[model samples]
Target: MSQMGPPRPGASMPAEKAKDFKGTFRRLVSYLKPRRKKLAAVFIVAILSTVFAIVGPKIMGMAITELFEGAYGQLQGVPGGGIDFGVIGQILAVLAGLYVFSSLFSYIQQYMMSTVAQDTVYDMRQDVNKKLEKLPLEYFDGRPNGETLSRMTNDIDTIGSTLQQSLTQFITSIVTLVGILVMMLTISPLLTLIAVVSLPLSLFVIGPILKRSQKYFSSQQKNLGRLNGHVEEMYTGHQVVKAFGHEAKSNEQFDAVNAELYDAGRKAQFISGIIMPMMSLIGNLSYVLISIVGGVLVIQRAISIGDIQAFITYSKQFTQPITQTANIANIIQSTVAAAERVFELLDEQEEVEAVTTSVLARAKGAVAFEDVDFGYGDNLLIEGLNIDVEPGQTVAIVGPTGAGKTTLINLLMRFYELKGGRITIDALDSREMSRHELRHNFGMVLQDTWLFNGTIRDNISYGKTGASEEEIVAAAQAAHADHFIRTLPDGYDTVLNQEVSNISQGQKQLVTIARAILADPPMMILDEATSSVDTRTEILIQQAMNRLMAGRTSFVIAHRLSTIKHADLILVMDQGQVIEQGTHEQLLDKDGFYADLYRSQFSAKVAI
Candidate 1:
């Protein structure tokens, strides 16, 4: 199989490698530790089943030998020695019993294993979910949603499937191999040697194929993740693609990723596909050699023909397990790779621990950023930035794109840790409080209005769980969303689909505003909350925002200059520096950068 070269830029998921297999396997086994008793039961039952199953060939051999000897004696003129019907019946009955018991034990083993597998994966997924909640926002910020989704879904699913399928098969294959090898040895050691000798040849044929297939399988999984990410990202932004006439380029990129996935998948499948045939070929050669040697031994009276038959059956059984084990070996490689991906996410650095200090109960909404220096990675975007806000003051931040306006907001919320400095609320550093408590103090309405698949009432109440229906209605009324909610087909009970495209963008913004209003936090952060609305809707949103912002410290990242004209303090930012700061009129009177920007908006309005 050909290895894939460097991936296309942004058209790939993080390339997955088979790393720390032993450690991952060890951790994986730890999931089974709690269910050790059940696993032990499964192990014992599998062994008993294989033992029972292996006894059949030897028993059948004895029955065949008895019949053969009886017939031979009759041919030599013994009158009543033609056949032993009673003995044959007994042997058949015992064989049936062995088979029945074997099947029963096998069934029980499978049931136990299924329970163990499901339980282990259930615990694993729960741990991963908990880990996700504790991870810093930057962890997600630096990766694509699809990559995260892949680990949570696809990689975990791989672990689940391998557990459910491969784990039991692996145990069964090993047990069967040992059982058959023992049975063959009892029947004829020479024939067993022939069978055992073929083992090395099988390995010689399979080892290289497996070693090569692993890389392709790893590549295949990665490409699959990338393809899923591309599809998800493209579909999520489909409207943008169509609006900007970028569908051709999008399709071209999708094709490139899809082709990579196909290449890796085909190579992996093709390599794994060769294992069974090659093993069968080796088994066949061994069988011929065993048959010739057993025939010669039977003529020499060293072994019965029935023993030869039994040996042949054992050889077939032996090779079957070997083939299955080899396939399972390949599957384990993929499973390990998947487990590594899941464990990597589970091992991500969590948010910084809250320090022990006085908790800020009933926050006064006064916030301060003191000597705050921070960066996204190594790029120092915000340096020595300091700001202080009084209770119930509206601070409007205006900045060009990438001017660190939102980054500042992110720091204020502790979504990203400060490189050096402190963010304090009510004179207490935010790090002193639990993240949940710290975040609970602020209600945010971002430019992107995200509404899940739920009712209008549910979306509104998302900010305040257990909020009564009446409270939901009140919040909607305050956000000027109540009338529209009532006008909808199902009113508050309307179910939203995954896309949430059922409502207009302005309506979605209203829903989010209703959510924020319901939260009723001490502080509010509105980042262009009205950017998605039309002029009329913007007027309504602005009015609702004014009501929501009442008696709360608010940080408004304003895009439209007119919205912030009445703000208590307007901050003008350029290239990550505070270029100007004062009341709107005061800043405008200075005739500086603020004035030029404020004038440009009106000039554009006049031109229009």
Candidate 2:
């Protein structure tokens, strides 16, 4: 149950918190490479907008000085001269021009960054899905459906938003902040000195807040994943919960995690909220310090009034950028946390990819397991085994619970690699062949039936993607599913939303069987294929399966010993190994595990 993630970095707050912020910022910008030209446009626009923003205030200060010095007339001849409407018009025109550029560039930056973010996320999703298909069954065995889905949906969305918005904002803010600093120092180092003195204090307050926020933010997401997993469990097992009268227990478990998530979310958000207000308060206080001192210097006539006005404007300018810097730090931290999780899936070692490909090589349905040893991870499910099934033979594998029945099928399909030994189809090793080539030879019907949200015909034809309508109907008839399928609203075209939930369980199994039958693989695996159906339906499906196994090598894993009485080779497995092998009557006479299981299960059914 342990997560196989790398050691988490720098959760504990370092003494130099700003240093950590800078490091995280640098690392986050590394993913913007593939669209460098588009991003470069964003960068140029961001710089221009920030420059104009700083220039706007400087222009206002210049306007005030122009009125005082009689270059532009003063309002109502109040200070030095009459107002010059002509020059005022020019200033306003330039200001409007700069506003136009800023607005237009804002749109461009957002459009470009959003495009990059979405495209990169699209690529990530496809790659992760491909990786999931490549990973061995063991990886999925330890996880629940909801958690895996949470990783795919909620987690991916979080990563996408962070990459799209946070990356753009943080980058723009940095460029803006640098411009403000340079302007502030150029206007007056003395006032800029007093304004920037608050930097150490802003860091002092926000450092701990960032660290605490990061921890709680991470915990909140983990709790979200758990809550999602719990919800999925409840939904899938709703019948069990209601039947056992354990709904109260389930509710209590859900409430406990819900409460934890609420607390963690509030704590993280509260810390983030406190940061902005504190930064504002520090900025205003710094603004006041610079304004008061600069006013005194202007009154003493040591500095020009115009210089003092620009100095005051730049003081607040510098302080506003400082506040912007704090939000940038927070943004980067949250994004890194999200990316860390996303990258985990991106970097997982794909289930050993095959070195050879032979898709056109038709298997002769000769399957041999030579000295195979395997397990779900380290649990040791199967050990050093040997079995051979020639073409056109029906092999039945019978076993008790946890006896590795389905495990054998997984090995043959290359869903899990053999820990030791080789599986060969017509002399070529399974590992040497591409998984698509190896699995192409199989038509499998699992005990747990799964029907996607599609029409009955669509479900059946899923295996054979390009099958004609005649072929689909033919496969359905062979599986005894076409009769009921015809009763639906649109018949073969009737869409089954949220799975084929309206159909009976036996019908669902039949439809699944039809899907496999449509593929018409050279080998088939029926793993307790009829375990869910009624006696009458069981017989019908059994008849269909007999036809399926006629010319193909087939293996049936079942607990119903009666079903496999006529198997060409019957394997009775125990504790992950074959304890006995023979047909039904042959095993009944062995007086071994097979006989005892047959006596317990078959005798009761026959007596009934």
Candidate 3:
């Protein structure tokens, strides 16, 4: 078991700044293209809602002016002097109607925008999922599981929430700003000028805060992803950590990541949080100036008192949108950062799509590797490797660790593309056949058994879709797992937990063997499939595998030399090339590498 190690230096450092903000933001907006109609509705409805709400203060001012004039006439004992409550009632009715329509349209806009947001993200998630499926295996091999998961879940979620909430707020804030500005200018340009002065001050305050907070926002997102990755890794491997007594070390690493996240998040929130209060203070100062000027205009009979009342209201409303737009800018900045991460995943190099000029419905299982050259990166792991297998031959590959045994299987199954030469199945080029067609012809049982959280029957039936109860039971019996499976409380219906720890290791191997048996493909690949069982269970599994491999082209990667003594052809591999190839007796008679390895293992067993 491998123990968890400390995080690499600078692992918690803020991610590099977004490289293409405009490009990434534009791409993010493209998801909305499909829902442009709905988005258009949202935009128009937002404008209408703001328009109605914007007219409210002006209309209410009329009522105030009517009451003021009426009260003054009554004080002068003029005829028909009393305040006209009837006219005020009519004004209130119209005002109520405006508010009602404003709220209704606001709700409509919210509903429409939410759907658009959800639909856009739905398409984005679908695209990300499809891209993941098309990406080459090397992408996964080079990245951490948790890091990839954070991109899929956390990063996408950030995009979703920003779309749902911030996008609509952004639309409404702009419209509110424009509408309130128009309403204020109609009342008095001088007071409007006083109100507009606050705009520059507000911007001055917000500029530095935004610039300072933007990096922290980016850092906050990056550190959050790192923290998620760390937590996921530690939680999943907690058993190993405990067994290795690395709890203290794991905690130390966690603390380091957590501390970094806290620092970034605190700075980001604190800086962005200053925008609102600063905007309010500036708005208050502008309000004082607007009031003094408006009061002077009203005293000079240059403007109605009611108009001054309405101008004050408009000034407050004007500054609000500016504040909101600043906050939304911060939010959009963070959203774009998240979108860039998702786009990076989407832009990964995909596996070369297979062009099927020849379709093999049922292969004869004659697999051949001719002059094959391949490597993970630059250094060739296997060069000029040639191998041929006739139908119905059991070929066992024996090699030390890193001897290219698994790489051979990976190439055969088309998991990785060959670098120099081509592989053939039934005399047809593997590349000419679709990967789906090529991989479907083989069933594999690896050292690490994979079983999902489902019933035993479902897991077994996974090897062959729609496998009947009889077929599943027969396959289990063939693998020698049926007897033990029946002893459990739920028998075939027993659900495997997520970890599949309900059963012993040997039992898990047996279940996997049953799954392969049910598959019954034309060829089989077994990678130390029986290595996890006891002696008796190993013998049972070997017998089951022998039966499974009969009359089928099977490749077995065996570490224990004794297991492949009966194989028709045994290839002894070292350093990515086969050094010897013959039957067990022939190799022993030659007294080559195979003989030395066999003797060593036999001697070790005897000593034990």
- CA RMSD for every model? 4.1, 4.8, 2.7
User: Would you list the C-alpha lDDT of every candidate in the order shown?
Assistant: 0.86, 0.77, 0.87
lDDT of 2: 0.77
Q: Who wins the lDDT comparison?
A: 3
Candidate 1, residue 365: CA error in Å?
1.3
The top-ranked prediction according to TM-score is 1
Rank list by lDDT: 3, 1, 2
lDDT for 417 in candidate 1 is: 86
lDDT (tens digit, per residue) of candidate 1 on 1-608: 01111223477445666767789889888888999899889989999998999999988988998899888988998867788878988998999999999999999988888898889889988998999889877776666678779988998889888888888888888999888887887777777888899888888889899889888888888887788888888888999999999999999989988898899889989999999889989999888888888889999999997888888888888899999999998888888878888888888889878675768767899899898888756767678888889999999999777777887888788788888889999999888888788889999998988899888888999999899988999999999999998998999998888999899989999889999999999999999988867999999899999999999999999879899999988888876668899999899899999999999999999999
Between candidates 1 and 3, the lDDT winner: 3
Writing each residue's lDDT as its tens digit, candidate 2 over 1-608 gives 01121122211222111224445445445655677888788788777766777677666666666556664345455564876767877877887887788777777778888998998778768867887776666656655566667767887788788778876777777776677678767777887778778888888998998877887766666667667878988998899999999999999988887887798788878988899899888988988888788888877876767767877777666656666667766665665655555555566767777568544367888889899998755666678898888888899998877677777877888777778999889877888888888888888888888898988878999989899999999999999988988988789998877946788899888988889889999999988888878999999899999988889999998878889888989988777798898777788788888889888886798799
Model 1 worst lDDT run, 10 consecutive residues: 1-10
* lDDT by residue for model 3 (1-608), tens: 11112233334555767778889989998888888888889999999999999999999999999999899999999998989999999999999999999999999998988888878888888998999888877676666677778888888889989988998899999999989989988998899889999988889779888877767877777777788878887888999999999999889988988898899889888888888888889989999988888888999999998888989999978888999899999898888888888899999999897667998998898988899998867778789998988899899998788777887888898778889988999999999988888888999988888999999999999999899899999999999999999999999999999889899988888898899999989999999987777999899889889888988999999988889999988988887788899899999999999999999999999999
Error of 3 at 418 (Å): 1.5
* Candidate 2 Cα deviation (angstroms), residue 35: 1.1
Worst 10 residues of 2 by lDDT: 1-10
Clashes of each: 0, 3, 0
Q: How do the predictions measure up, each by TM-score? A: 0.95, 0.89, 0.94
